[model samples]
Target: MQLQTIVPIKPLGNPINYKAKIVNIGSCFAVNMAQRLQYYQFQNTINPLGILFHPEAISRLLEFVVNDKVFTQEDVFQHNEIWSCFDAHSDLNQLEQEDIIEQLNSKICRFKANVFDATHIILTFGTAWVYRNKQSNQIVANCHKVPQNQFEKELLAVETCLENLKKIEQNLRQINPNIQIIYTISPVRHIKDGFVENQRSKAHLIAALHEYLEKNKPLNYYFPSYELLMDELRDYRFFGKDLIHPNDLAVDYIWQKFVETCIHSNEIPTMKMVDEVQKGLVHRSFNPYSDAHQQFLDKLAQKIDVLLEQYPFMNFR
Candidate 1:
């Protein structure tokens, strides 16, 4: 007797209209994806804190971008709350929690009220781990030198995470019921958790998330970000020196895959020079300092100078 093995296939939904505004949240990989979408001229916004509260620095970073100012390394670092150099002079931990909460509420309200009209929300879950504040009994974006042992412990169950996501969706759906949601898991490993534990944690998350996606209906979708990174580009060369995060090449590969799979077509708008550079990088022939490449760099510099002249608020110099 011959036996047939049946494979369950996910339904291929209708192609997403490229006209919608997209909001990306979650991890650094989500940030990379957002950047590519913005480069391609899609109406896109990236929430640096994901579902968490926004920091003051992130607001300033968005202000700079909206004004067409050139973003500097310092600006990026500040936006992400990395204070290695400046921490010596300032007690970043002393920033008022109430003020942060107010700012975050204001921004979230604005997005929900004005930006949710025709938006697709893409959420990435980095990990189940979270740090709670002892004083308020609330989860925080960062621990900020607060004694870890003082806080009550909680690891977000998959159900809790899914409920939070559904709440976010419901809030947006109030403004626009047609809103779509995409979920992805960050492939970047948390090496601080130790190799064996890290793998175990990721396995638990993936399994839980996959089960949730399978049970949920069409309003929510799961993108294979984890699979693409782990299965398609598993080579060590694709990762950075950290051996956790994807290097530039790997990032580009994932971005390209996203464009193909999610964006729907290659006809999306992109800067001509950026397109050229991307093609060069894909073929492994990009030389930033090359004479011909310098021409494009010069043009980009000229554009930046014009922007700097126009927006005196940006103090990149």
Candidate 2:
């Protein structure tokens, strides 16, 4: 008997241009992608409040929105001042009742309300696993030093994830029905989890996300950051010493693939073009550096000069 192999669907053409206001949510990998977009002068927002790694942050955000509060960076810094507030001598209940925390909560609520107007919403799920507080019936972003034994647990179901995503989409659509949603599975490995478990976890997220995207059609799309890293550049050289996160070179490679697959579908631009684009936009001030670093910058400058000669368009002057 002959068996047929199923092939994955590839992205069809250049990314459709829409003057987009983008919001990125989920794991650290989302941060990396957001940085790349910002580098390219794309209007994008990645967690306006900052790194939201746990369930408490999510809940707090909702609470803030509902209450009509304004948040500043100082407020967030104060919230995360401790390593784990739940473990500290301070009273958790009292802290929750504080006026500042309440104010911060209101701000988060407003942010969520504003998100519905975003032109594009991008989410990257890091894991299916989540911590839950049984008594409170709420998701906890972090255990907050609560004893591992006492902290309740729940693994997010594929169905639950899909439902949540649908709700998020629905809410956004109410504000702007034409908004587009993009989902990506973060490629950064979870080193805290054992290697075997990490792989299993990633597989679960990817499978769930893939199925969800397929069922939803054009309203949602999946970007292949995970596949590009795991399949194309699987070598150790692409990873940092930590063995979990991609090194600078790996990130650049994945970014190139992203541009190729999503931004320019037909022809990949030359490295010289990439460099020229970067230099044209870079506004950083040069500082005195050691001989080695200076040498590297000097070589880069020379290459830029040569490329300018070859392609006069690269000369901003």
The number of the candidate with the highest lDDT is 2
lDDT at residue 197 of model 1 (Cα atoms)? 60
Backbone clash total, candidate 2: 9
Candidate 2 wrongly placed segments (more than 4 Å): 1-9, 12-18, 52-114, 144-150, 264-317
Instruction: Report the lDDT tens digits of candidate 2 across residue range 1-317.
Output: 73422224356232633245677776777788888776554556776455444223433443444445554333322333442222111222233335545544543564565576576777776765666666556665556556576566555666666665555555556556776767777778876766776777777677666776677776677777777778777788888898888888978877776665555332234443444557744534365466765776676677667656754443333
In model 1, where do residues sit more than 4 Å from their true spots?
A: 1-18, 48-102, 266-317
TM-score of 1: 0.65
Give RMSD to native, each candidate. 9.9, 8.1
Looking at model 2, residue 93 earns an lDDT score of 22
Best by TM-score: 2
lDDT of 1 by residue, 61-178 (tens): 2332333343223321232343321111122321444444444444445554433454577776666565565766655555544456856644566566555555555555555677
Q: Predict model 2's lDDT versus the native.
A: 0.59
Q: How many pairs in model 1 have backbone atoms within 3 A of each other, for residues 3 or more apart or on separate chains, i.e. clashes?
A: 0
Models 1 onward score TM values of: 0.65, 0.67
Q: Candidate 2, after superposition: displacement of residue 42 in Å?
A: 1.2
